[model samples]
Target: MNKLKLSGILAVIALFAMASCTQKKESNSPKNLQIDNKILAQNLAQKFIITDGHIDLPYHLKSMGFLDLKNTPTLVDGIKGDFDFPRAKKGGLDAPFMSIFIPPALQKTGGSKELADSLINMVEHITTSFPNHFGLASSPNDVIKNFKSGKISLPMGMENGSPIEGDINNVKYFFDRGIRYITLTHGKVNEICDSSYDPVRTWNGLSPFGKEVVLEMNKQGIMVDVSHISDSTFYQVMELTDVPCIASHSSVRKFTPGFERNMSDDMIKLLAKKNGVIQINFGSSFLTYKYEKRLKERDSLKRIFMKENNLTGKDSLAKAFNTKWLEENKLYADVEIVADHIDHVVKLTGIDHVGLGSDYDGVGNSLPTGLKDVSGYPNLLEELLNRGYSEEDIEKICYKNVFRVWNAVLDHAGKNN
Candidate 1:
């Protein structure tokens, strides 16, 4: 009860209050908060097993004539493509469905099946050449096993169904070869279905044989990818498929209006209703209309310049002019635009029906600014975090959504068998 003791106790309490206030100020500082988010984003990127629905690495290599095992090391170290072993690891991409993109021309030239086989063989060769870094994944369980062993899973998806070669049995053949999904058509109408880009509408939808192909796919447990198919074809497949399907790398048409290559609002809604997922494509043209408009303007200007200078497209002068123009007028969507596509999907359908299907090497150089390669996934994760997405939401968007559809397809096939 002494005056000196009371004064001493009051001073100690004031010091404790001051220290607590200082701690609160530092923790809430903008810079400190930003740093915390960045760290959290990076940690999440590594914590979850990221699975991209589509990546065109197999065809990219075939086009470059680098399918031989001698060039296998480039897949781990080369910077020529958006996906490589090192970049995928940095981005936390555990399973990227390697697109076995068979061109439509091969359907008429009489070598579609052979070409598909060759590409599949090349993928097999890569895994054989570098067993420590890459593993062939035939199922979701395989992907998880590869991830646990610190290896990237190379699951395959055929970009065009041309490789089916008009034989219903070919569907099972591809499934046996590790082809999990088959995009019915690409750039042109084929026996199975019409393409979004082909105005001919040859069959007006799925051909008579195409219906059989769909049922065969369902029986064989292969996903039917509706990416480049015509609207009629898409509807037909949706009706025919018994199991949930996926649009492996298509964006919503809300941004690019009238671009049939992207799915419409109605299509997305129907897809979600059927328990399917539409993986968002990260290409700038797919994300926004601005990219296409700018691209057209640049091309028009380049054509005028070449005509004025009497330079052909093959001429070095024309090429130089095009490059310079593009540099000055960069036509690209940023990471935020990509997130907008994701947001639109989440709002239209719940978060369960949307996932990442960045058409990495397939999109050429038109990827969003910060997401230029496979290593930019953390940038995307950070954007989602900033938008108030919970960790559980991020996990579903990362892989669980697609895996649910995948496992459903497998289960359907098993039950039928």
Candidate 2:
């Protein structure tokens, strides 16, 4: 009995000593850069896996022929983009859903299956080609397996419903190919639904085809994503989807109404009741109300400029604008702003429905300042911790609630998702 008591006492002492040491390390670091913040932030994410539900890796890689993810360019080096395997590990990022973003081809020549194939090829190329760094995650078990194997999760998700091209079988085909969720639309209307960001309201709400698509996704056990969807389409999905859904990356409409990229308080409330989570999008336009107006105005002017220059609908124009602005101005959203987005969702919908989806790679150079890379996640946590968020709540925002929803959807899906 004495020996057991001694062992227990020693264990308690060791734990205290370790915690005390950790606190000391955190307090002693004058700068937030590379000062053991990883360990501190990870401790906060332990209640659930530290996860960012959406990451546009394939799109970014396809768009920008950038260097390998294993070797990323840091913010200090003035290289803007910085999400890599090492950084994700440092951030305790467990399950990062890699979005297979299908770019809009006006003609719709290749068809959804071919596009799905391209997306799958990109995912497979990343996961199979580099086994040491990443793994294919199809289910919650896959997440655990990859985590245990010291590998980053490369979950496949579809950003635009067009990949299904009005066909229900494609939804199941996507699931079989390891797609877990499907965003209803993106920037424009498709056969499935209308987009909130579209200048012309294509369907006002979900079309009959859209309703069928939602039903098929639910039957297939896939979580329906409502992020780039029109308000009516959102409501339709809301009423129709039995499984919990999510806004993979969206902001609060109250903060920036006309942007139409963020969800309203009423929508947020409904999402909460429906057991859905909205992973806060970290784009500057999404965060501040002013930026939305600014972005639209600037984008409009740039479009006129491109048109005058005979460059109609050139996608590369946006990239050029981003590069120009980043080089010319010091204006960038801070890590606090990201925390503010998280706080907004927490304030409007409570802590349960909020999650982080940094929208890394997709936004290119527009990432939140201190959070320049996956490694910079700790800075956001420190800001959150400073704001009086409990370790438990942070866990839910970081990953627990997301996982809970994922698991709940899994239960609903029964066989897949």
Candidate 3:
């Protein structure tokens, strides 16, 4: 009748059910399993700090048409399905690199600079409004110091390179403003280099301007992100930067090769050689091969339709159906898929060069059930444990590897200590 009574009765029923199943099959052979404390830790280390390399909260704040960014919970509600402070705190996300995403379309005019300004303003708003909850960090030391001071570090990273607006000096300008990393392009190619998702050819690999961007970012101690660049472009980037570059939100090409989302085995090995980390992305489309292929196929069909109907510009076509499909299959991807990639990277490049980058709020709605947001990080720890990862290894994947890389970039960049 009461809560305790109800719980005990349910437990008896569950035990009886399990006993019946075991009675039916006299085998301890393993299948799909749901593990509890004997197999999982109830109170894992609270001091085990995990840093997510990517979370697009600032961009979502601006684009979601919200004026007040003061209340984090309210903003989380507005996201409908993205991240928030409470969710992140509960999820063990100690350090989150908030992407200062400048949309690719905005790069055409002075829009790049305008977008950068707006995004940077959002970062300022987060720090100023919520000082106790967040702090702006420039280097890995900033992250450690901020975290130890009882505040979460919300560092800024330039997601798209168009923000520099062709001026290499501004790369240093961003790094001075606590911007730690920069992705060369977005979904579309920019003045600097070709896009991995876009077919249009701007430069075969890193263009002359792109070369300068890499060199300058390396010198400024900003980590170069090669997530959205083509395979040719990735190799070219490897050649350009003396320091290591990160695939901040990417997975293994062993899962999906044709899709530009994941990197090849060769790339992984090379990334290790430079002491770079491949933070596995948790997007369902990127994790599932069939879903990724289906989305690409749907988009290709839509392109053909666009050409056939003499469509001049973009409006409201059914081009984004793959997005809908991804939403439907979001459940198929779980912590196991995430662990699988981490395991592969560890096996290929050792555990030092693999990490977690949720890519939250950037992709469409297709996240694993447990790893749905910043709050769901414990699920990853649980999976890694099941996969036989040591506590030290888990902590490394959580943040140490990336932190080490960050520190390495700082030393390599020859920044003033």
TM-score per model over all chains: 0.92, 0.78, 0.81
Q: Report the lDDT tens digits of candidate 3 across residue range 34-119.
A: 25421343234246767888888877877766424544445323346567767776676778888888878787656777777767
Candidate 3, residue 326: Cα displacement in angstroms equals 11
State candidate 3's TM-score: 0.81
Worst 10 residues of 1 by lDDT: 66-75
Task: Write out the backbone clash pairs for model 2.
Answer: none
TM-score, ranked from best to worst: 1, 3, 2
RMSD of every candidate to native, in Å, equals 2.8, 9.4, 9.1
- For candidate 3, the 10 contiguous residues with the lowest summed lDDT are 29-38
Weakest 10 consecutive residues of candidate 2 by summed lDDT? 71-80
Identify the leading candidate in terms of lDDT. Answer: 1
Task: Report every candidate's CA lDDT.
Answer: 0.90, 0.76, 0.78
Candidate 3: global Cα-lDDT?
0.78
Which ranges of candidate 2 are over 4 A from the true structure?
1-39, 42-48, 65-80, 292-330, 415-417
Better of 1 and 2 by TM-score: 1
Ranking by lDDT: 1, 3, 2
Candidates 1 and 2, the one with greater lDDT: 1
